[model samples]
Target chain A: MTTQEPTNAENWAKPVDSLHIAHDLPDHAINLNVEGKRVASMTSGFGKMWQKTYRVRLDGARVAPQQVVKVWKEHFPEFWQKGQHFFGPMASISPGDVALINVKTGGVKLSTGILVLYADDVSFSFMTPEGHMFTGMITFSARELEDGVTQAEIVALVRAQDPIYELGMMTMGSGAEDRQWLHVLRSLAAHFGVEGKPTLEKICVDRKRQWKRFGNVRRSAAIRTVFYSVTRPLRRKEKTRASA
Target chain B: MDFSADVRQIDGLAVIDLHGEIMAGADDALTSGFVRATTGNTGPVLLNFADVSYINSTGIALIVGLLAEARASDRRILVSGLTDHYKDIFEITRISDFVTMCDDEESAAAAAKA
Candidate 1:
């Protein structure tokens, strides 16, 4: 690596002042907790850190890694499980793009977003903004195995962003996350006309929690989204009265 | 080129010389290198990336995993020889917060001794 000629220079997103969603989203896409938020890396979260990987071999598909990645990037949201909405930009997934997500988990609808941290022919990654359920980077990629099978994989290095999320992670949130990625891989494999059984590996990278980050609860998107929903009727009445 | 890691002791610091592109395939080399570097040494471990060609997002996650391990063991970490681009990356990923970034091997060794 040299100062004048950095390798893979075009593959990374330029450093940003803060995250900003530039794309127009659907009418129902609750666009909160993303704009003006700084990306929350694994270090910034409050809970124990974990590295979870989900993988599935596309058996008999015979697709190259780059081809799989290209298809995945082009149809990114279609592979996600139902009820989890990802609104990517009109263009393909690229470095610096901000994507909105509306997901219903345990009967609560939460809206959050991710910054496209890096992208290349074989892989792309998303980093969560502050107030997301987890602070982390999720990378999706494909690689060729020894037997010439292309394996699609998702690796997430994450930690719960607040105490409430930490509690959820300890209960049902972690398992739900696992299932979500598994569904994605299965969908991707099915797209190539193959039946794929995904495998998972979880590693507890750090057991200690950062107690100092307890204040992050104030920025929780779940709490904010719930409040927004609860006060919608009042907001509608206020609008009607003002118009009259 | 394939990824490789070499560990050397400099002024009691374990300096890991890293070469080649760092991606998902480099996991074994990186982990084994860290283990060898910190096995008996109580001082800081320095990762010298002077010869590294490229690092993807997966590579960055591997470094974060290493940082987590170092913190868990109460050990210090030092990084040296990253290009300007990766220096920015280290900042963006917040890895610079936990590890001391040095410009070259000599200063890193001096700091390790100090």
Candidate 2:
């Protein structure tokens, strides 16, 4: 076993003017709300900031931390719940890759994407882009505990991107977000033949909302998705008439 | 390289000199240094990354957490001595949007005074 020095700088993605999803995704993967969008961080969000952690310890699984992370990155999308679709890039989950996401929540389908900000042997992270439901970063990691247990964890530090998203978070969006990650962890553990029960910890980092960011609603992905869905028939008809 | 943080006062500013590869294990030292620098201090805190060798995603998140703490308390944070590469990383993460980035400790002190 060789311990490699962490070349952190090289592992990070180069700075981009805006996100561009270069990956060719499946037909089911909606690529909206991603291209030409800037990556949004905690400072650009509208609602109160929160740091959420979901952890699942592979109790009886015989896997090293690095092995767990490798598998997690390789099968990244496979762990997602049924309604959520993750379309990874051709090169897999490397840093700077842009992946499309199609999520179905409460019977409403929305499209968004994330920038793979950083990736290493034992961990990786993603940063949300503009018009995303939240403005933040989520890190996935696997580490060996003191008792020799390999623990897989997901940590999200985020804030709602706009007032509408904030309201939804206050209602059903927050629980849905929680369940999504929890399900992913459970599924990952189950993939290793372990029935892992995930634990969650939520902490509010900041109580004050950034009212200035309320204008971010102008780029709301949910609204755009709804509009796209409602006008699909009209677009199809126009295309047919033009071809005729 | 292991992470180490030393907090000191320079011209009324709490300047934390960080040395090492900042990864997951850096949470304790980083958080303690931040708390030590900001406790009872009304002025902006300067983080000097002149000697930093590496910084992973976890390290970035730790810095973001510190920034959140500072913002919550109405305090400011200024960063200095980041290599051009790290400067770009900060920009990509949008940490540059909230904190002032300086070329060196001297400039960071001057910015804090400003």
Candidate 3:
């Protein structure tokens, strides 16, 4: 059997760019101001017991931080579980700037995490948990592939310590959170100025397929657990009756 | 901040019309409403969305979560009367793919009945 050469479409499927922003962010995180409007106040750290860079994106914009915080409090419970917004009476954001916010957390410490931000038309912020803290930074350089769609190319680098290795971590979970960020990127792009239907369609199709695969895996796992649960007792009963 | 849900049985179908935005602090209400809508229903449930204008990621996640819960119970949940803006957001997130959408309350109710 002859194998067909992979097409440009297959090649374009890869991310355009990705960077470990957790490392390059300044220890004293920089303040993000949008045209004199303070959007978010972030703090960064390095070389701790966790060794991972950490940053906190406090919501501030034209809207009152209190109002945004209220909205966040009203809608997102998982964030509340992370910690109380003690930095100030700040709001996360409401109905603007962000199209979506996706978060992923796992591992023994549950300290490692990734937060992806999809702003307008291919803008993104990847926040990775380092050591015991999280770092926040923007990865601004992304280019469109021949498939005529754009993907994020993260350029930020870090040098303090390899948080993953420093933490003595062995495995990294799947980057499903990263893929969701890509979808948010595409949606933001379309929301702003990108007018390519095919590109948007391709992104949607890819996401649907990915979600379907995830669903299948979950369903199979559930089925297996249920099957074992149902049969375990039967085997015990059979052995008891046979011995009698 | 509080979610209020009213479920009326019309033509043997459960029509769940929700008022107020579904966000973080009010998850309990939303989850309870969904549970009530799907529980003990012999037929489909049509969710009326004309009044819901704003939903955060958590709110959207609740909808998905409810859908998954309903699916396990073999109950069908359909959304109707979504504004264009909300529809656009839902489309991108692909929530529409999992649940059916209708243009108006009547059609959604009818679909549920059928």
Model 2, C-alpha of A79: deviation from truth (Å): 0.7
Q: What is the DockQ of each candidate?
A: 0.57, 0.51, 0.01
Ranking by lDDT: 1, 2, 3
lDDT of 1 by residue, A1-244 (tens): 3475566778888887688989888898889899898887667789999999999999999899999999999999999988899999876999989999998765568999998889999999999888999988999999999898999999999999999999988988888889889999999999999999999999999998988889999999999999998998999999999999
lDDT by residue for model 3 (A137-202), tens: 333233344454343332222111233322222233222223333443343334334431222121
Best by DockQ: 1
Worst 10 residues of 3 chain B by lDDT: B53-62
Task: List the candidates ranked by TM-score, beginning with the highest.
Answer: 2, 1, 3
What stretches of model 2 exceed 4 Å from their correct place?
Answer: A1-6
The root-mean-square deviation over C-alpha atoms between each candidate and the true structure, in angstroms, is 1.7, 3.3, 21.6
- Judged by DockQ cut-offs, is candidate 2 incorrect, acceptable, medium or high? medium
Off by over 4 Å in 1: B109-114
Cα TM-score per model: 0.95, 0.95, 0.39
Clashes of 1: 0
RMSD in angstroms, candidate 3? Answer: 21.6
Candidate rank order under DockQ = 1, 2, 3
